[model samples]
Target chain A: MADYYFKTRDLKVGYHGRALLENIRIDLEKGEILTLVGPNGAGKSTILKSITRQLEILGGRVAVGGKKLTELTYQELSRKMAVVLTDRVRPELMTGHDIVAAGRYPYTGRLGILSREDERKVEEAMELVNAGGLGKCLFTSLSDGQKQRLLLARAICQEPEILVLDEPTSFLDIRYKLELLDILRRMAKRQGITVVMSLHEIDLAGKISDKVLPVKAGCIYDYGTPEEILREDFIRELYGMDRGSFDPVFGSIELPRPGGEPETMVISACGRGIPVYRRLQKEGTPFIAGILYENDIDYQLARHLASRVIREKPFQEISVKVYEEAREAAFSCKKVYYTEIPWGTANARLRKLLEEVKGEAGIECTGLQEQLC
Target chain B: MTEYSFHYENVRRRGRYAFVFTVMILALLLMAVININTGPVKISLKEIAGILFAGQTDGTEYDIIWQIRMPRILMAAILGGALSLSGFLLQVFFHNPIAGPFILGISSGAKMVVALTMIFSLGSVGSMSSLAMIGAAFAGSLLSVGFVLLVSRRLHNMSALLVAGIMISYICSAVTEFVITFAEDSDIVNLHGWSQGSFSGMSFGNVRVCGVIIALAFLAAFLMSKPIGAYQLGEAYARSMGVNIRVFRVVLILLSSIFSACVTAFAGPISFVGIAVPQIVRLTLHTSRPLIVIPASFLGGAVFCMLSDLIARMAFAPLELSISTVTSVLGAPVVIWMLVHHCINS
Candidate 1:
């Protein structure tokens, strides 16, 4: 029974009898968060809609709690699954509390008057989402972040075994996006509820999801654990991004390197070169960086943005080969900017090298800030 | 913030509902008494009360009280409530506050069929039963609903849907006019007056039938408040919350049609009561919850229609105006104000 708490097989979905995606398969355990990530209009929403029964499935079946989704009565299905859609439901004259309480629909009596227990659950859900303070405010009057939280609160109050959302973070600010995902993580862990959602933030998706499904052109491209699927090549191919680069290790994105030959050499270490590298990238100046250890903090940016990087092994002294390369590169550049590089016994040679370059190259030392201004 | 305001809002909401209900009920009773006492041949309040409570005495006043004013007032109240409920349902269905039975051409559909039935039956049998007229009106209402459903499939715009509805209404009215011409010249005047809408000449039989049908519809609507409340969030969320959209939509359309059809069969195509009354009740109650709005709208509709009926009868003493004239004069401004407010807010 626990093998696949929610499963879909050979699923096909589309509008007006034409399939947009086909041959899809999903199998999930209880309490797992499965995230769908892809470029826009890649049928991510269509797949989510199909599994939640919002759109009719063109083929195949979804089974929840061992019952076929199509065969179960709506009431029975609702008790097991809940959804927060992207549709803007601007219900008039309803407070946030009223919107959340509407999630108790299946549990309430015929008239949908909430019981005392239902009220408690609603409060709990709001609290969990950090939306307890927003309960009395009108829904339409709330900010987009507040509305998204209230929607999550509403879905939480439903108390279903499975929850599905479509692009839940689209309208949220950075803080709210992180906070909402945090709440979802806690809910998934503590309540043992399975979550399926499409997210535009691949970095956050990779962080939160137990499994990641890549929605791509006309089909399910791949499905696996985030660690296996979130590679640099996969991210590049998945989005078909021509410009810019995605760093899988840091989950950071960098714009394509400036399109020109090397003009400047940046001398810095111990994370000091990051800002300088970014300024150079923005100024569209191709540059060379470092005789620093490979594991240095600045190495990450320099590796992506710099035309050439002079490197040494981590925790090792600057080698003769690296020093020769850095000195030559510095001389070949028009100007050189120096940033604070913390000196220690192992890497004291960098200061000597800098002094030698300044004398031979006839470049005067200037503060990095003065150079930027 | 959470602790203090939550309880305060609950109390405020409850208090507002209480206040609106009390005011509406009081107004309804006041208008009923006033309508009963003030007429072409005025009667004293004492005599009106006596006729209502005590057994009827065989006199003109007694006949006027029991036979004429009582049924007319009751019909206005019952059918008005029915119309408002129908409007509320249509607004919910279309997600537009201005949508109503008349605006959707549902009442015109019912009116057309009832007119045809009246002409054909009068020509062949010289008379038509009230039940037969209601049945014909209901059939016409469904026919218009079917066409609207077809239009809804093709056009998603609310105003476009209304344009289609208005076109359908004009076509139905034209056909009704054509049918009335086929009847004897004597019947043309009657048909024209009836089609213009009136609350006069309501019989006890019409009152009883509309009363039962409307009572049942009200009960059903009230019972379905849970789904209606969920539906206010829109179709996707409603379905996620266990509402079967296909079934719920059919039920909504059928109930709204029954309500408007009943009103049309009894009182011709009354305007704006369906759209205006529910909105007024919602604004007064300060909530859109179905449980509260449904009952309040019925009472609000009753009071509004009664007031309009009274004004229509007495505004030009012995020169009674059509009921639609009063309702439109009162209702159209509110609709316009709502449209402006809606535009600004959105």
Candidate 2:
């Protein structure tokens, strides 16, 4: 019974009268950002288009601001909501300013000439998106990232209660993607503009969205806070990832671990083993990584790239059982590589294990040769 | 700082628009004067001015100026403006620069229907009323536009749509030619000249009817400029801006059809004015904002048609060329250039 700024209940959406996705439910409060993340062709865009009324809804109810979606006229809906779509708009002889100014359609007079206030809004929107310098440039001449920023500016200037975007960062590079998400976050928090957008970048989605909707084939899979929905197993299942793993803590992805028996044992801690793990992964050498605390930063990546990762509990002294396990694994490998570890109470047993392994025939220590000081 | 620049850009754009409008109006007036003054019977500028402004209806020069030359000039200007506006609308509708009534076969369709009505009515009705001719032309225009829409639904490629339009034009022209060849000699004499396209022998009554139709359609198009501007961004964006796209599209087609049908009814499918004039106007104004482009296109079309009519009248001197022949020579090159330019840029 809570009053949601935007809500869709049991909605069915698709082309013609048939529903591609049904039984969909969504609830969003004012200023909240909701993101849809799914594999390609999972009907994310269809859900967006349906809510925007670009595609007809086959069943159920959609409401905005306590009004049924079907009851609001197009002009009313336009004033309440705006959208940034994936369609490539190549308007001839239009500058970036002109393109952004089109967002004032509902506010303009019959001839669509901008009033002084509307022009100011357009300018402010462009400034917000860092597109002020691009105002006079021909829209067709802009780079994909610049064009996307301008498009976002256009939607922002509409001053709607709800803003919808479908894959707004598809063509942007890393920097622009971060910049755009930052702008969206600012707009939602400062302006109280509700945002509903689909994103292909799950990492960005988890970082920026207040709520997350994971859509699967023909239905809404689940909806919750990003912390609840962005778990490693859920993301792996949502994307049907077979050859990789998702790290929920860092929102990082790692390719599948190498196959076969361990050829080398790498002993490192405090973020030193990541590069060795990656190189061995690239060379397709099956290796075991070990004596790492379970909570070490390197263990996160090591779990996905090493054939086996031997570990001890965080802040605990290495037990005899664990040390025995590490020693056995190290001796079984053809080669042993160890990095200098700061001697500590918890991992004092590792120093002994490494010294014993150094006496063996095939062992190497990095950073030992650079210790002139 | 950007606010000041935005204002400055707006002022500069307005100034450019003013300059273009002034030039188009001046050219239109000059063309009208040349069309009135230069013919086999050379009426001096002073005499032509007197004849036009002094209300002198007593002499042979007055008769020539008032009766033969005046109506032809007015028809050329009015129908030319209408044709160009029609082309601009079609371009907006199809999102293709090359889309126009003549190129899309709507004009040929109108020409075919008018010719059939002329032949059939020559025996029974003796002569067709201007209203009847426009009605027939409108019907033909809708038919061709309908077929184009159907084909466009299946073929999303620009070149393929144009090919379909050209094929429709060929079919209509073939039908008209077949109908013309079997007609009586007197009907052939009237149909042949009209089918070739000319501004000759236009009555003041034809001028009055077409003037009213074009003026009304022009007003309707002007009022719809806001939605048309939104539409230029593409359909989904336009709809998001609250334009009722289904209704807007239908009204656009209906208005464009009315304008082109009025032109074809009076002037018989004058070629290239529709496609060439809007493109020229957009290039000159350096904006396709529709609020300015619509009126500018109308004026550009009027000037272009008046110039083409002038050449048709005096180029051979008494062995006058068809208006279509002159327009084709001038307008076809613009089209070719547009295609080449589009290719290079894309």
Candidate 3:
């Protein structure tokens, strides 16, 4: 086994007698999918191309399997590596089978005539990507998602040790995006191929990646695990999205809206409220919760955990103990968000407190549209 | 027996029967006959075939069918097929629909060599035609390929590759102009007519040489079809599928250059056929699969060149027109019509 595996040392890529990217360094080990994440124009694709030797390296070096890439013959380099580009030229009439069969070219004759063994490899590759049924489908007719898979299948047929994908999931819809990554994850683990890719989906990257490289401003900040790299602070720094939230329930990181102000007061909802709570927790934003039945989800969730909440009957007025409890947490804050609650005469005292919030802090009172508040 | 049976079949996996390749061969056969039948001296089609098949000709029949029209007809077919196949290969390699052999300055490279030979009046008197063409085309085409290779050494972007080709073509064009401007009037006239292109003056000897060269190139291209298909998607994708792109591009340059340069040498620089035939074939087939496009364009070009030669010879009888003028005049209008139709239909 090669000890170094793969690494890029101070690599630069250029075109038209000009440099497109400069001073890049990257490394990968077996059983790791190192995803390069960056904003558009941050040279994410440039790094992949240089490493794969699709683009020439100007300043530094790329090594694969302990050999300098430039020193290797085209045959030697191809056996050690494969690549899936975001976009490329395709012949108008090629079928999916023909596309996949191309990957076996390095192993085939000078004329590119596929032997039976080559044909078998092609079949296996298409099967691995679940694109076998699309073998006869025209290249021009394939959906973007299908075409992306066909590209991957072609790479697989090469039987390379390192699989490099450039935004492999870009053309896929939500479900197919995950499906593609699932295939990559399996390829890395089962085949022991080192997988490298650039992806746009933050949460998906956080979930599946064994290594995360956050490329920002031409500098690579590598976080060794998903947990550390998926940090709210890290995302905010990269995307300038300070208000973004990694939703615990949906398992999604919602990017901060362009000009969204953080809530002055965060109201609590039960099951899906954990993400909002986690965001507030990270920022040290204070909050209050109430409508406590004995073992209620949010009220009990609030009491024993952190923050402050009022415990009382649903129809009851703002009783002294509960009022005192709520007032104590709110003493330092000006407003309360009474969210999605029914409005009625039974909640006369609660309305008074909400009315006072409007009077003192000019906060809009909510939950008045429903009957029981 | 086994090999023979297998060869008798289409040989492609999960595609149509081998009938397509066979039909294309048959089409080429019929076009070859038409090319041989029509020329300056009227020879009946049956008599022409009989003279060719029986291997005997009386003086008048021999001069008309065997000697006069035979070489020009064969030259048109060989050069036409060669140029078109070269275009098909190039368009696939570049992944640009409009890309052709001449786009990379192969013709200019050959032209430069031709110009050098013509200006200096260099070479043996008997072999001047052959030597000048072979020398000029080989020198110019190799130089252009070298330029493209050097650029590929530094840049990975295909668009950047395209830019390098266009720039080199410009440089070659500039040099050719300078060479022509300094030459004598008689040399200038021969060069101009040659550059305009024709097949009328080709002797049997020149035709035989061109046939051998085009055959070698076409065979080389035939073996390259699958890899070229992979290239159609992009170089990176082609590479991932085990293609050694540097090797492939070098071979492709040589193949396209051989075909294009031969046409320039024998028929002059018949520019538009190399660009247009493949595009037309692509539209007619409704697919750009090299397996089909390669042979289709070859046959199509043979027919096109023959037909164009006929029209040029007839349209102004007893007053010969340059072959390039006819192809361009016909080719440009058809291309414009096709583009408009493409825009309208699509």
DockQ of 1: 0.76
Q: Give per-residue CA lDDT, model 2, range B109-132, as digits (tens).
A: 999988888877655223889899
TM-score of model 3 (first chain only)? 0.72
DockQ ranking, best first:
1, 2, 3
- Among the numbered candidates, top TM-score falls to 2
In model 1, which residue pairs have backbone atoms overlapping below 3 Å? Answer: none
Candidate 2: misplaced stretches above 4 Å? A364-373, B1-4, B121-126
Per-residue lDDT of model 1, residues A1-373, tens digit only: 4479999888888888999988888898889999999999999888888888888999998899788889988888789888989999899888999999999999999889988899899988888888888888889899888898999999989899999999999899998899989988887899889999999988888899999999886756658998888898889989999888877768788999887778688888888888888998999989888876789889887877888888899988777787878878877877788887677888777888878776764654444855543
Which sequence of candidate numbers ranks them by TM-score, best first? 2, 1, 3
Task: List TM-scores for all candidates, in order.
Answer: 0.97, 0.97, 0.77
Query: Which candidate tops lDDT?
Result: 2
Instruction: Quote the positional error of residue B95 for candidate 2 in Å.
Output: 0.5
Docking quality of model 3: it rates as acceptable
Prediction 2 global C-alpha lDDT: 0.90
A best-first ranking of the candidates according to their lDDT comes to 2, 1, 3
lDDT of each residue in B229-279, candidate 3, tens digit only = 667777777765657887898798778878887887767777678778888
Q: Can you give the DockQ of every candidate in the order shown?
A: 0.76, 0.73, 0.39
Instruction: For residues A73-142, write the lDDT of model 2, one tens digit per residue.
Output: 8889999999999999899999899999999999999899899899999999999988888888789999
Q: How many clashing pairs in candidate 1?
A: 0
